[model samples]
Target: MSKIAVIAGSLYLWLSPGLTMGQRTSGLIGVPDTSFTVHSAYSKAKKTHPDIRIAAPALPPTVQANLNVVYCNQNGRDLHIDAFYPVNQSTNRNQLPAVLLIHGGGWRSGDRSQQIPMAQQLATNGYVAVTAEYRLSTEALYPAAVHDLKAAIRWLRTNAREYNIDPDRIAILGCSAGGQLAALLGTTGNRKELEGTSCHTEQSSAVQAIVDVDGVLAFIHPESGEGDDSRSTSAATYWFGASKTEKPKLWHEASALTYVDKSTPPILFLNSSVDRMHAGRDDMIGKLNALGIYSEVHTFADAPHPFWLFHPWFEPTVSYTVNFLNKVFSKK
Candidate 1:
């Protein structure tokens, strides 16, 4: 166990009591609601802190995390995976499963650090959680993010026993852009991507489950009403890299809904009313039902996207997520 991990774990446990009821339920209960406090804590702790807001508030033997663990170091640019897990043993389940997490920032500007509180809660609840980083749209687009996330999974699997993780039970969770990637991982299933280094190992990067928090499921949808705000055309243009009509075929293939086969992993979709991209989440849910995939969408009446990261506002959303996970994974 690293020193930083120990410190982070202690901090999370100490501050868990500060969370509101909703935050407590979700299991991610430590982030301060006030912007100033958050700003101060974030800056002071910075890369040294591990753990994200978490679920399973009652679970014990709390652990902290490290900001970035190098998975792929190449050309002076390192591809990292940040992790949160238990610091010591818990008799409930000595070894924890994993939630392979990714953050959201339109695939262009998000980092692994944002979800420390969430990851910590997941760890406390008997899960080894990782919030991974990959190349972004500005640096590289399309499959770059996919490949990096896939690589992170492979790394986790290879070292599962060391981390006390259940390799077969690893799941993927993402928010916003990250959620889109998680959806993609679910749709892609166990099939390996063609990119990345030829590491001479047959490790698998496919996920057993997915959690999509306000993701983009279909780039072009028949149900799309004119002038709807699922996204700005310019943002989509930058992301999709072609007009909807110009790249219709590619866009559909890339969408999570298009690839929702029977083998697709179970998905938990979290939607917020205020987000413009909520429609995409709905379309994905419809497809999940059509394909007989066990998918559930929890809609917040008017919650803003990703606001669950905050302490006060996120309490309920966090609880909802934990209960959903408990119900879904209990059978598996």
Candidate 2:
């Protein structure tokens, strides 16, 4: 058997002894048991995919980075973005594709800096990449973070020429809470209500693709509550300003799954096998497939919720993300 197949088989046996290979194809099986051990499965997968390494590859000499460029001034705060792009223009005069990275902290903490490494890496690989700041739950409520993200999209479009970016070829990538926002940004593109009266209102906030890294899809669905605890539920309550039961409509409205349709952008979901951070992800992928929209899901065996932030898994995460983005952008 191939090395990858052997590693996968070992992972399946170690992680989900109950499920067959066919059953694990969707990448949503094997919710981590509380007593689940870690490191071994990921270590095996790493050994198998040896090409995936932690060190960021050297960039071309022409790559440039600009930090703390203000994208918006909202609620007495100046939202900033760190942009990384290549100085060398494309041969055909066509603008380069852009990517916006959103950081995650359950919509409460975390900052744009969390995604700086990825943004820089993307820029080095011939893309204009940006890491943007948005209002957290501590500063605002539910829709506020969403609005900030949409506004950031608008900001990119409005300043596309300045950054040598193709406005229509923009994609969004987010992890954890940011993943939820990125998913919502992709699904609710045409929804006028979610597009708040923030900066750059004239430009469309729609994205061409979405890369959601372990984000919740449905806030109130039964699957959403499957692996959640009181602390996670409390984070939702804090963000929405009410319990799910107290404001059912708000919770539903905030859910990305509620807005899935034919118009939703193609999505790539990267998740850890044992972590339930992205509850209802498989169902969301199923809905996207039903609508004929493109979707891909890859699960790293025995990985943690924040796998992308560390070594071994981080390399695979970036590889999959760059490949997916390249595929989606090339067709546009």
Question: Which candidate ranks first by TM-score, i.e. highest?
Answer: 2
What does candidate 1's lDDT look like per residue over 1-332, in tens digits?
Answer: 99999987775544332222122112223332222233443454334333333222432446867666787643345777787887764344555778888877666565777666677777777678887877654444355566677778888888776677777788888887687778887678556542355221467877777888877777677543312324654434444445556556656756787777777878887876655564466666676788787877777764545545543445655566667676766777
Q: Which stretches of candidate 1 lie over 4 Å from their true place?
A: 1-61, 74-76, 90-93, 192-201, 222-233
Candidate 1: clashing residue pairs, number: 20
The estimated TM-scores of all candidates read 0.74, 0.80
Which candidate number maximizes lDDT?
A: 2
Question: Backbone clashes per model, in order?
Answer: 20, 0
Off by over 4 Å in 2: 1-62, 90-92, 226-233
lDDT, residue 299, model 1: 77
* RMSD (Å) of each candidate, 1 decimal: 13.5, 14.8
